[model samples]
Target: MSEADVTVIGAGVVGLAVAAALAARGRKVYILEKNEGIGRETSSRNSQVIHAGLYYPPGSLKARTCVEGNRLLYQLCARYGVPHRRLGKLVAATEAGEEPRLEALASNASASGVAGLRFLTSREVAVLEPRVRARLGLLVPDTGIVDVHRLMELYLWLARERGAELVCRTEAVGLEFTGAGYLVWVRDREGTYAFRSRVVVNSAGLRADRVAAMAGLDVDRLGYRLHYCKGHYFSVCPAKSRLVSRLVYPVPHPQGTGLGIHVTLDLGGRMRLGPDTLYVSEPEYGVGEERRHLFWEGARRFLPDLEPEDLSPEMAGIRPKLQGPGQPPRDFVIRHEADRGLPGFVNLIGIESPGLTASPAIARLVAGMLG
Candidate 1:
């Protein structure tokens, strides 16, 4: 059996950040990843946009961490040579009826403490994104794009440098209360084994709820059950990829199902539209070609120049959501479960969108909890 001060399940961005934070504070940390490598799941998928804490309710964990994470992420990018761009984003109301939603979004953002947000009129929107057709728009200057893979690499490097060990192709299959901490049952390519840790962090991304259940939590009773929401992205053909310089989004769904099918630019300046939310029983990453028209119509409301032929199925990702269809939006659930009789067991569930942006801050929060 192996042992450590902390055992982190899942080596996604958040898990890596936690490892870095804990190890930097001199904790003997070991990161156990189910995959052969890291971030092959939700972490590698989805839009890599660094959100400006918009679109979330005020005083929520999503709002607080995103606002703080936006700043810390930028600093981390500069200090660690991570590839990123603060190109900003625009949430536009393409129809007169949608103006109220735009206003609400702006108000929510401001209430959440996001600075540099400017409400843009149609003319201002035209100046920023000439191709987009909108009645009004909210310019969020704090939003940007980041090479998430690079950021994850830096986190791994920092953690390893601080004596955190990353054990890949290892899955934390079970957890047993060991009086003071947990006896984590792990399965690797060779076989299964157990590790003793004073603390266990459940950062299993899509499988976070399952990990919590392993520790005897009634996921359903506590509302920790995760619903998989798959989002598909369609890439713009190179000929029409230059339609937007910055991210362009439609007014988000009122229930927060998604931020609507909009435009997202990668670090390479290529544009992709999509991530229409479709709740699934299990995780899947198939992007159907038939969904191209759905994406085209959604983008066409803002990008008037978009054509159906210009879109092609690109990729897809599954978000571990706490809310189901027609349900109200759910905030991230990050708490030390000591009160639940699982001392030193931290549960990070329903950490989806903005999770990438909020990773570092979430890590610090986790560290503070353990401290």
Candidate 2:
């Protein structure tokens, strides 16, 4: 109804973090979310792991932000009383030839300032996880899990407390750049309304490219590819819970799809496996029960004792991948005025895996871009 100094176009984890950062900096921030609640998309459907900056290429934004944000996020969690724990992780090499690749991953992680990565021999891994038959492993003590929904709620609460407004179920349909500022047209149950804002941030996770097109920008011309890769998860039975104590991953594919149907434990101590990358022509979020067989097959690679009946359909998430499966992974595309020549506009595209982990750092970067 009123003009805002800044209008963030999405209320996911990254968007809420950006809004909170801006509000904390004394800006009148307004968050427009298309869903009824924040983080109901990729943010809420993720593995909820606090990555230790592993797997990303050296010197990339994903590597840098994830490494720094890992620390910042833990600090924020502690300060805000958000539920989280440093459960640690292991990049196991069950295959004989995969041992060197695991070592290389450890090297890359160390270069990224991820401390406490110990190279574990077969015997060491045995002591840590007796059931897992890993030839060698890299133990990452900093990786952990968090309550993502609670974190987003905390961000929204802090932002609201600082005079930020959250308009839920409001979808931005069109954008026009006026002489002074941009005009955003939003529609909902109440119909369409026009709002004005000097700065507009496009943090729309899946539809970021569409939002950019709505703003009269070419999606492909931005020199970034927005590929949607769907990942499915299956929950492990409670009886098999004792088989895994920490997160266990296989050597990541150089393509950065985060291969190896690894195991992840949630805050409630529930274990789930999967997130196998599958590229689709269109972005789809629905995970059905028919995929349980595929999940069980993938899970048996590292977890040999897993039974086909032990898995149940859990959830699915899509990553805004910048590169395809076989191609090399690209750095996060955070385009602002410096690159796009669009003043008071910021675009966050292709934010995948570590995006959740690097959310706070991404918010700070967005703030810096605004300034």
Candidate 3:
């Protein structure tokens, strides 16, 4: 049996960040990734937007961590030489009657400590985004985008440099308590292997509930219900791309799913719109070409001149949402000794949306729990 101070399941951004943070604290960390590569799942997919803590409810982990992690992530990206840009964002009230709702959003954001939200009038909005027609908009200067793949590589490199081991193509099948520690059963291309760890951190992304089940824990009872929401993205035409300099979003719906099918730019300045929420049964991580028309329709709401030919099917990602549509958003479930009696076992459940933004702070919180 291989022994380690800590074992992190799942090599997604959150798991990698946790491993890096734990390794930085002088813990021998082992990262077991079910896939052949890191972040091939939800991490690599989706809108690579560095959120500005705009829509999460006040005092929720999503709100706090996203607000805190946005600051930390910007600093880390700079310190580690990761490629990122704070291109800013605009939450616009496109409809005439939506201005008050936009104001409420600004107030909520202010309460969450999301700095630099400048309210723009209709003329000002037109000055900023010539193509956008909105009565009011809130410009978030701190909002940005990053090369998520490169950021994951940097985190893996740092963790490995600090003596952390990343075992790819390895899946944790089962786990059992061995009195002294936890014995984890992992299967790779070779076969099954048993490893013992003093601490186990379950950062499994979509399969977090399954991981918890294998560990002999009931996820539902622990306030975890995996409601998968799939989002699809569509590519934007180069000519119409420069229509906006910053991320443009419509005021989020009361459902908590970011509504506006706003435009987002890649690190290379290419633009894409979408990730319209669709509840799926299978929830496999792949884009449905059938959803292209849906994206076109959603895009037309904000970009009136958006044509169907302008949209090309891009990609899709699944969110491991713990709550259902119209339900209150749940805080990230980072249960250590507080909720679970088991020592040195932390289960991260329903870490969606601002999870990327909140990753660093979440890692620190995980480290503190482990200690």
Candidate 4:
């Protein structure tokens, strides 16, 4: 890699989406992935849910991108023959105290222009999911799941077809800014190499801040701080997996990331209980069987029939957050930072939940920023 037009710094869904969009515009885009393959990090480790844009606050980047992404993703899947299912989700309230939260959620969804969200009584919940023992529920019909790997492949294929180059096993280690462009220092199996690009987009997911720092940007003052949050998942046994169809979620934790220990189904109809958030200092993805008891308590509220042994260790994924523990939830940080004295250097930080869903929209936003 000697000279390039635009270089994207990550190969996660958002990075791939950005590369594909720029390539489609005939930008001579190059995707720089540190890993041996694409989507191996945050992209592959998620619940793969196509979010309904209901959880995010109105007027935030996450809200706009997710609602728009939800529509665009469905269309992209249909157009590209990507595997997905709009199974819809049941946001359940197990107690009388949690009922108001249901009302608030529906109201909030309406505010975000997310249509087809309606309240579900206990009877309605029983009709939809007989095993769920919730007193009240909110049915978000647009919520769904996707084959994340297929989605990434589709993005990469489209990008490659449009003349984007994906160089795996090459990690961006340093950045040198020229008057017009950037010098990206990267290392691969062979040795260290450098590429010059007129434009550099840092869509590096968890390590986005580090990428920003390499460009001589002050991350702290730039508000590019990132904290790692880990979420563990458990797979339900086959017998119990068949019993659930729609995704079921408990009422959100007030000061938490929302969507507490919830149940998500894959395209194969396998049930997975997960993604309970725990702040960690590093990126660790080992699922602990010891969490089964805690998982049982949280899941058994809605899934009354789930037994202790029904849950098995599955996997874990970490979120790179701009907001730390006990802090107010922050919106997605898509900074052009020309004001920070770095033009053509965009930093996408704290892109967690809905990042997968908002990949396409985020890509469009980044391309627009570059232009």
RMSD after CA superposition, every candidate: 0.9, 1.5, 1.5, 0.9
CA lDDT of each candidate? Answer: 0.93, 0.87, 0.86, 0.90
Using lDDT, give the best candidate's number.
1
Positional deviation of residue 321's Cα in model 4 after best superposition, in angstroms: 0.9
Candidate 3 TM-score over all chains jointly: 0.96
Q: Is candidate 1 or candidate 2 better by TM-score?
A: 1
Candidate 1 CA-lDDT value: 0.93
lDDT of 3: 0.86
Ranking by lDDT: 1, 4, 2, 3
- Model 3: ten consecutive residues of lowest lDDT: 335-344
TM-score list, all predictions: 0.98, 0.96, 0.96, 0.98
Where does model 1 exceed 4 Å of error?
Answer: none
Q: Model 2: residues >4 Å from true position, as ranges? A: 288-290
lDDT of 4 by residue, 296-339 (tens): 99999999999989999999999998888888898999878788
Stretches of candidate 3 off by over 4 Å are: 337-339
Mark the 10 consecutive residues where model 2 has the least summed lDDT.
333-342
Clashing pairs in 1: none
Q: After superposition, how far is residue 289 of candidate 3 from its true place, in Å?
A: 4.5
Off by over 4 Å in 4: none
lDDT of 2 by residue, 94-134 (tens): 78778778888888888888998898888998898888778
Q: What's the CA error at residue 21 for candidate 4, in Å?
A: 0.6
Candidate 1's TM-score reads 0.98
